[model samples]
Target chain A: MQYIHPKAIKVWRIHGMISAAISFVLFLVLMLLGLFLFRWLLYLAAGFLVIGLVDFLIFVSVIPILRWRFFRYRINETHVVIRDGIWFVKHTVIPMARIQFVEAEQGPLLRAYRLAKLKISTATSTHHIPALSIGQAQKLRDRLAAFIQASDVDV
Target chain B: MKRAHPLSIFAGFFKELKQLLLPIIIGALFGIRHDDGMSEWFALFGIGICLFFAVIEWWRTRYQVLEDQLYVKIGTIFMKERFIRFERIQSLHLSTNPFLKLFGLVRLEVHTAGGEDKAEFALPAVKRDEALRLQERIGGSNRSSQEDLLAVLDRSENSERVYRLRGGELVLAALTSSGARVIFLGLFTLLGQIGELWDRVSFITPLRREFHRVIGVPLLEAAAGVAAVLLIFWLLSSAIAFVKMYRFTLTVREKDWVIRRGFFEQTEQIVPFKRVQAVKIRENWLKQSFGYASVYLDVAGGQAGDGASEVLLYPLIRKERVAEFLAAIRSPFPWAVPTAAVSIRAFYWKIIKYVVPLAVLATILSLWVPYGAWSWLLVAASMALSWLGYRDASFAVDGDRVALGRREFSKETILTERKRLQFLSCRVSPVQKRLKLMTVQSGLIAGNNGYSFRICDLPLAEGRRLYEWYITAYTRSARRELQRVDGESSYSL
Candidate 1:
């Protein structure tokens, strides 16, 4: 079993920061409305500011660190096991025989950081290994693909 | 590999008309309500256009069975095409409703293992002999061998009777089933609509008005009226269920399971042994009390006609006799039923999840409401229910099979083979982690919604072990089956 790349913490923090930015903009709009339109709505503006602060502290700062600390995955001869989450930890196991396909996806932010996400698909659902280095994602995908192919060949 | 029977055009037209029926009725209701002639005429015009298009679709549609695939092309403007491999075809169902039976034709519904929302392809109406030929062709080598086995079984002196729901048992089953509630709700809605449309002469509106007039009290009279209506609806629904589930019989053959059911429209569903994905045993409140249960099978890519779900194994069986029923069905998994109890601490969790907040809210409500004591009763009942729920929850794994048991108002135990599981997941909340607990959820590939089951608040370590064991066993069995299939497919190639 191994943890995902250390950079996943940074990626998660970046994701949280983006959410915080959106919330901050929303707070600004509410504050403007409170100042210019309705005085009673100033209470709403204050609540919005508090929520934004909490979002930054929890989602951007503390949560990602906890997630990175706990997240782990392992692949064996028969199945792939994934364990992750901060509030609700999940452990998912997909049998090698059930692996329908595997792919590596690089988003703009991930591409900028030279990271890729590996998605393993089965008959019903897809699981992801987030924030792997581009090369690592490619290598892992190839290895899993090879295992699936070899298993199929044996069958 | 030919055009369907000429009667298909009539079937296709009626099928399209059936879909249009709802909207047309709704439009007519609005027209009647508003006293508008234009809307009614518009609905009529819409029906005319739909009929015209349906005829066009029937004329253009064509299907052919090629070497390895059944190809179907339909529609003109939409121009849809489907190419389904023969091996992927899971079941070929031959069904004849009254309309089709009149012409000695049956609808051939072809289903595949792709798990789509709709059937892979349906030939609306085909001759019985032609449907049999198509079924044989699509099935190929396996069908012939299975037919030979069936022949042998037929020649045997005595054929085993697997399970049968007699008339009395079926009535009991229907009374306990959700079918009664569903029917009641459906009819109630229909009556409500009619009442709305014809407020002056309506049956319900006048009865309701008379009740209000006679009682002069709104709430009390309303309650009495509802009770009366519900009683009537229950009886009506029971009759409907009796008709729908009459003569339900499940028989075992050498290589298949045959489910014969229905009174007015006798339907025969044949599921080959290899196609069976999962089995379930369910008991509602009444059924549980009577020690009776219903069993359902998840057959891969199988579809039941008239939009009903997969038919039950017998609709009624003694709870203690479930093992015999499973054995009679020739389930492949080991027979031992070893249960792993959910942690006792789950009681507290259930209380926190269901009872505590509701109780708090009820207490607050008691401060304002005149009948404050009633709130206490509700809170007490909820607390008792939560405690009962904790006592009933358990999960077990025996060899290649997993059984998840849970109770809300009803107790349901779903038994599925490891290889049938399409997905399995284990979740541990922060609270659960502190309690050393987790929840395991699983889904099968059989139903349109993908029948899923969950076992909550199990030991985290045990949950992980179950996940590992399930995946490993599932993969090993799947590989063995695949190897055998691969060898046979190679020979064909």
Candidate 2:
């Protein structure tokens, strides 16, 4: 098993911060609306603001580090195994013969960090290995395509 | 290379009419209710458009049987052409409805191994002899004569009556089946439509009032009426099942297996042995005790009644004779072997996973309802069911066949050939990891829908063995076949 790209922590942190900022803006709007609508809602707005701060602190500061540490994947001749998730950890094994295709994608943020995501698609489900170096993603894609071609023969 | 039967124009008209039936009926109803001439004109315009398109479609559609493939050119404007290789055709069927029969024509339906709905190419109306010839060509091309001859010789000398379900047996099968429950639900929806019509029609109001007055207690009478209607519907559904599966017979011919069944609509499904994906034996609670089970063939893209994926090999038979029946069918998949039952710890795990949370939710829900204690019976029943399910679950991987027996008021033993499986995987939940258990999920290509089977809470060692068995056995067979072909020096024209 290999861990995802180290820059995943920073990527996840930025994602979490962006969502947290949106929540904070929503909270500020709610507080301002409460001032015009009702007095009790003002206290509710204050409570929401406090909850948002705590949520942001945990999501941006704590979860990304844990997730980056835990996410791992392995590719073998016959199957691809992915292990991830925080509380109820999920382990998925997709047979190589079943994979329809493999794709490498890069969002603007990921491209900025020289990272790409590898998606392995099968008939039933698709599994993704997030935050891998572009070179590794391309190699993985080629290897998987070769595996599929080799497996499809004679069966 | 030829055009479809000339009468296909009418077939196309009827096909289009079936799609527009509901809208046309609604349009007519609105026209009548509003006393408006506009709706009638709109409907006339719609019908004209449908007829014009149907004729154009009939004119545009053309099918040709090339040396290696079936080519279809359809669509007047787009002019789309599709070529289906003979090797990829899983099933070729010739069917006739009353309209087609009047013109001595049959619809030739070609289904491919690709289970997409659009994968089917139907030549709406073709001469019966031409369709039969095409069926022979496709079936013959799917497997060479030499290989089929070898397999046919391996069986018993008699290629006579393979299996036939008795009328009593068919009736028993229908009586015990739970399929009528779905039919009953469908009927309820249909009745709801009628109820809406009853509400809308003013003439029925007085009749309803009179009926309620005569019934004394209207509510209880209505409930009784519903119960009576349901009983009648159930009987009707059973009769339909009987008609649909009447004289269900499997005959082993020289070249392929022939399945003949149906009462109102006699259907003959000819399946080449090579195209079969799996053989499944199912036993309901009653049937299990009676030692009777039903057998179905998972032929890739085989179209059965209502577009179902499997063709019934035998509607009902003694479980003890399943091995004999399978052998008679010359199915490549081996007979099932009873494997170890699911782990006992899984009993507790299932209880925790399903029962506990459901019980909590039910209890909280009962608080809002007037009579909540009755919900405890449901919780108890569910817990007992899960325990029974855990106790009954079993799996085995023997040679080329992987058999999974699961219980849900019945036992379904699925025996799939390793070569036919689309995907296989084993997973472990955190709780299962602690308990040294795993669940294996496997998918098979069967029709347009996703067909998957799962075996939960097996010992980790057994799960690993199953995985390795699949990988090694599948690859070894592939390599051996390749080597055999290479060694044969396949020099062909």
Candidate 3:
């Protein structure tokens, strides 16, 4: 099992805050439209606050649990297999040749924590594994790049 | 740097204002009747907002090329910077209207391979000479780049053998084909105008009373108006067809096919030969009578606003010339071949599929409406249509290519290559599973141009064989791998 960096909690918290802010604005608009009573509007705001708080709590509290549950990936001869998913276990295997591009994204919060999200894009879809240490993401990117380059030669 | 013509802003503003005026006026009238101040205020606010936008557009619209990329910077608040790479550009099209022609200006459109919404980067107005110069530079650069790629592919000689249709051939093709469809459309427009006028004069009692009261004329004067309206409509539709399709010509150049159509707003689409996924030559019963066929190309670009990624290459052409044209493109299908017609089972299946809906509609109409048996006529018509569809359904394999001929409102024949297939999937539904049947769908993703050719309902074994063939034949060398054993040393030995 591979552990996501503790810094991921900050990223989740920031995302939750942004979501809550947008929802609050929407709630205010609904209130202005006279769709809900004053008390109902207060309750709705409170509910959104609670959601935001819970989201932040989950980020901080659930990281260790997820880290214990997850697994890191390394490319094999043919495919890249990532085994992660808590209650419902999933093992995803993508062939190296199918990879279109690989990217490392870092938000301000993630950058502060020296963490990044590794993204793998294929012709059909994109997959992301967030909260990797900068060094780890770089190493993984290099490994995948080398593997793909080697596969190109064999083909 | 080429700036869009200053007058374009006014043109856009007026065009948008004209479109919104009817709705605004109607809403305002409704409001006036209801004595609603808010609706009046809304109308005023809408006009003000539109004027503001027009003003901003007039001031802020600008476009310029930066090195190998073209950028159009527009909007005031939510600033948008659209960048289009030169290499990604498929074609640079120029068009002009009478208004634009007065200024010696044209609209420039840069088309790329993707969704229709984002496929074109348009500059509404640019000086004709400058637009031409820019188009030439961009087109020349693209041609050189393509030539370089062709040289790498070792097919430079083949690229040199480009084919172009002469003016006489284009005119002949247009005359001998279902150009009569344009005539029929004109007639339809005439009928629509007559219907509108009849509704206005007969149904709108208040308008008629007001007109009579103001002019002190009898209702018979209004009845005379219908003749004038019909004549105007006839002239309008004919003029529209003439303007839209006048001087339509198709030309094939190295690694690209160009379709230059329209008179007032001329459009030239440069379609790369490699981007063509499927070639469909269709002949309806009407076309067959005149020995004409319509060619539709399933190119890897955007849809033709029809929710289908198929564009009509030559809407109407001679059946004999199809062979010559296709051969010029190195297209891999015989123009004329005896196709295997659909089985009787296919006809029965189609009947069963359509009959249920027809029967239900007939039952409801008969039970609840005065005209009951008349609904049965619809069912009969559907039965006949389904029979025709089944009879027309056919598929043929020509070398490494596959052709499917199907009929709906019109007959459609499609020919595609195995190498063009992007992905192949074999699907089994519960019903098909019971019958031991499978549906194979082969998709070619040459950008966002949707599926190239999809054939459904074949035997499972046949589907698997085709899927294997597609994988083995079409898989890029960079993606192919040797069989690897996880276990079983004896098998390896």
| Model 3 clash number | 0
Give a tens-digit lDDT track for model 3, residues A28-114.
665564454455666666665566566546644674457444645545544554555553333344456445567888988788889
- Order the candidates by DockQ, highest first — what do you get? 1, 2, 3
Clashing pairs in 2: none
Worst 10 residues of 1 chain B by lDDT: B484-493
lDDT of 1 at B460: 71
- TM-score computed on alpha carbons, candidate 2: 0.74
Q: Candidates' lDDT values, in order?
A: 0.69, 0.70, 0.57
lDDT digits (tens) for residues B318-381 of candidate 2: 8889888777667767688658656888888888888999899788878986445556766887
**Candidate 1 lDDT over residue span B71-151, tens digit each:** 898765888888888877765666667888898888777765544646767888888777767766776834533343233
Highest TM-score, which number? 1
**Tens-digit lDDT string for candidate 3 (B373-443):** 55686688678767776666555555457666656555667677643443344555554444444444444
lDDT of 1 by residue, A1-155 (tens): 79888888888888888877877887888889889999877788787778788889998889888888888898765678888776787878777765768999988878878899999976557888887898989988888988777655221
**Lowest summed lDDT window (length 10), candidate 2 chain B:** B484-493
Q: For model 1, what is the C-alpha lDDT against the true structure?
A: 0.69
Evaluation by DockQ, superior candidate among 1 and 3: 1
Candidate 1 lDDT score at position B459: 72
Off by over 4 Å in 3: A1-155, B10-55, B64-71, B82-91, B112-120, B132-243, B283-291, B301-309, B318-321, B328-341, B407-409, B428-430, B433-438, B445-447, B456-493
